[model samples]
Target: MTLYQKLKASGNPQAVAQITISLLESHSVKETAKILGVTPRWVYKLRERFRLSNGDISACIKKRGPKFRMPNRTPEHIENLVVTLAKETNLGSKRLALFIKNTFNIQLSPFTIRNIRRRYGIHCRKHKTLTGSRRFATDFSAFEPLQLWQIDAKHIADQSALPPEAYASIFKNKLPPFQFTAIDIKTRLRFIAYADSLDFKNGLTFMLLVAAWLRAFGVKHQLFFQTDNGAEFGGSAGSRKRKLIQKLIFDHWNVSLLNIPERNKETNCFVERSHRTDDEEFYALNLKKVTSRTSFLKMAQNWILYFNYRRPHFGKNMNGMTPVEALKFYRCFYHPAIGSMPVVVLDQLSNYTSLLFDISSLPWDNLPRNKKLLNETMAHYRHSIFSTSL
Candidate 1:
């Protein structure tokens, strides 16, 4: 390649301009053009710019495009609005455009929104792209709302998800240490409950509460709860205790407990993914403000309400609708109550039940009970029981 061609190929405009200026001092314009692989007229223009700018090599660099902004460019105010909304919502270009159009009656295209985001250094988080085979492998189109729910537990004291003060406050204030989460695959509708412990009793209580909440809303379909093979849900495969727990759920509530394959988390991806959202959008933002168990529960309830009824989701099956909106979109297949399921404190419910009936009176022969968990639960509720008696 020619010297100029090589300089240009280096993708450095400053280097190209300096080299062209250095060569112009010793070589004729025609000879310079020949060596630099350029027209004599182009060389003459660079020399003139160089002389006009008092021998500044930067002047020799060709300026591309129009000197003035395009008349059709987005208005400054509109671009500012897009940037503000992008920061506030962290929505992608397409969704931001749609939101802008719907909220403000503006007609900005996604391309324009994308450019504004790029210019402002605002970026949306990019999710991993699923392979075509894996993408189409599990078809959820045929699933109806309330048919399949993915349930999982999230440790709320995680440092990665909570601020330092919030993490410390979790222990200092004696807040619930675990969050039990359940999300429907069809509508992305979710329910959450907080607990002080991560034991079989709490897990069973969470499922029972969720099932009862759904049924109260007039849901008639037989529901399925998919969970990981965590000891909380049930022990690993072939454990007799796991079978009995599954049988208990089936017999009492007609809700089937399905365990994901051993060591394969992808099967419970729906609820697993929602845990990250809880960390980013819910816990991290509000946990720092929590001062007590009651305040934390209230904050959690508000977050769940906003998530189900107000926040828009752009997941694979959601199509940019909030969970309630998605449910409404499939109104024919969903009960209205499914959209408004309440969040509860699992420990409180378990404690309330324990107060009503002696723990030993219930069926416990077949299931292996944790003595430490049982004693801790009773002791935790002992104060409430004494207060109620007084």
Candidate 2:
């Protein structure tokens, strides 16, 4: 009900009028509503009644201010600065604002910088390095480097507080380094580097670098690059990368282009999970000290190399081998069977990683005649499997 209605219902009209006047004067509709135990709309109605009763108050009340203003300087220049800085270093609002203030002599609040970002609709995202939920994870297994590659990019956080040199030179321009990473799922060899741009050229260069690294390490196999449908992975509709992969890679190698469905593509689950090591080992220790992108990237590269070659992946096999060892072991002399499908146990997860083998690969003579036995054969691998709902 309106405050007028409330007052008319109340025995004390003068007291209600005084309280309403106090609330309108103080702009404390929330407090007044709580005291009166009424909605703010009722308070608003009271203000409108009083304003209508006194024409002088309505005529004197000023108009509300504008929500946005045309930026004093060129917005193009600021956008360029923001994009450059975000790419070179992952410094968020407070630092960006302070950097502008100290270096360019332009005093900007963090909120203003956020507004500037919103104005242009520039999004800067850092994929989280850890996973508490397994919803986005993928299921794939092939025990060699070229069998499959999981790819993604991460923005490395700038951990250092404002240093004099950084404020003077780098921060003045708003340039930060971006980290692009690709991981071979089977062998777990990582291709990680800090780059200034995330363009098609960079994507091609990253792939070439991985191919070169594999060749240099005497790793030879038909490569199957599996990645999300990121812009970098595939070019714009009917673009060069799309043509290149279709005409060249697919025609040449035993390529398998696997991607998470669009709905599940938001999180880069496998490689993102690998970033936990990047955080615990690299960023956590070095963030307090390093400011230069060059220095930080060098350290990051070294750590990633060590992780791929030395660090043991507890998830690969029940035998507990590093990814390299497991890949080599599988490649050299492992064979289960050729008839029906082999029972590949997934000991770690409660769920099944069902294999749909090519019927063409096996002989018809040894194949299962009974569908029930085939289903039971697959189920018997996992002790916890309750049904063949898989």
Candidate 3:
């Protein structure tokens, strides 16, 4: 039979693929197309499509009609039951179909139930499944500052309505809404940077900034950066930015990168909890204030300061102290393995320095003269008297 007759009889993409393969083995594209009664361009297109789809024969098929539909033979009462269970209990299609079979003595396929739910726009209905997740205490945060850091980014809605500028093409302005975040596990001290976009490149940039900031505090212990297995973090495709990070941050600074299990947020519990706090306190309160990209960024920086230095963290470890307070606690105490640092005071300007840290990053430059120096003689020598409160 002719090639057209063969394709018409089989009426399957696989058949087309098989015939194409046979023809290509013995003939050129032009000859194959001539034999098939189609243009040579069509043959080349099919070849490319096959290559891109990795020779999946089904890729050659013409797409057929109608994605979703409730079966016509299904009774109206069964359809109603599917919708009712979906809305009330949020049972899945199979379970709902089984319920219909048992209670109403009606046999409804899961497909029929799924189609019925889809018809009423309830197909995406979800109910919580029993999981092993629970609130639990962990001893993983016993390290000194910079020994461990958790990094992650959260996305907010883009509220900007303005159009692009004329010179914005080469360096075009399109700001994506993302809040790149990092936290010291032991101190609960955090770093949050707002950015217009978030990708692997942006993630690496945030890490560099965070490391530099941490270095300024003299907390330059070899650190482990824990993050989820996101494409941006773990790296994917052509530009494996994670590899570059391994060479730059990990190799250079003696830091390491770690990935928690896929979809296992609990493994990266500290950052996840901080994100919840941001949702409750930051985003919910300031969403309306984010009129422009610039304004939103300023607001985000303020929130980060409040979170790290002002807002108290609750835990036995934290002792109702803010993150900076917790850091002071750690600097005086706590070791990686042996536990608790020596309280060796070299009698530097720590009193003035620590006070400077508390004055807020932005306002420190504009602070009154009296606040910058030791107005009072604060002693920390061995002979110096110590005071404590119960």
Using Cα atoms with residue i matched to residue i, what is each candidate's TM-score against the true structure? Answer: 0.72, 0.43, 0.45
Tens digit per residue, CA lDDT, model 3, 1-390: 768668868856577767876798899999999898778887887787778889786786556676755366567776676787778745567656655666778887788787777778995422222355765355654666557888887764422221122113212323345667787777777777655555544566566556545555565578788887676564532224556557644577666787766666787778867776665466645554455545655766677777776666665577557776776675644232211111111122123433322322322123466653544444343225554321
Q: Write the residue-wise lDDT of candidate 1 on 71-165 in tens digits.
A: 99898989889989999887788778878888999988889999999888998653222333332134687678778999999887887656677
Q: Give the least accurate 10-residue stretch of model 3, judged by summed lDDT.
A: 337-346
Residue 30 shift from truth in candidate 3, angstroms: 99
Candidate 2 Cα errors over 4 Å, as ranges: 1-133, 136-146, 158-176, 236-241, 248-257, 266-268, 318-320, 331-390
The numbered model that scores best in lDDT is: 1
The models' CA-based lDDT, in order, is 0.78, 0.54, 0.61
- Name the Cα RMSD for model 1: 9.9
lDDT of 1: 0.78
Consecutive 10-residue window with the lowest summed lDDT within model 1: 127-136
Root-mean-square deviation per candidate = 9.9, 22.6, 20.6
In angstroms, give how far residue 88 of model 2 lies from its true place. 31
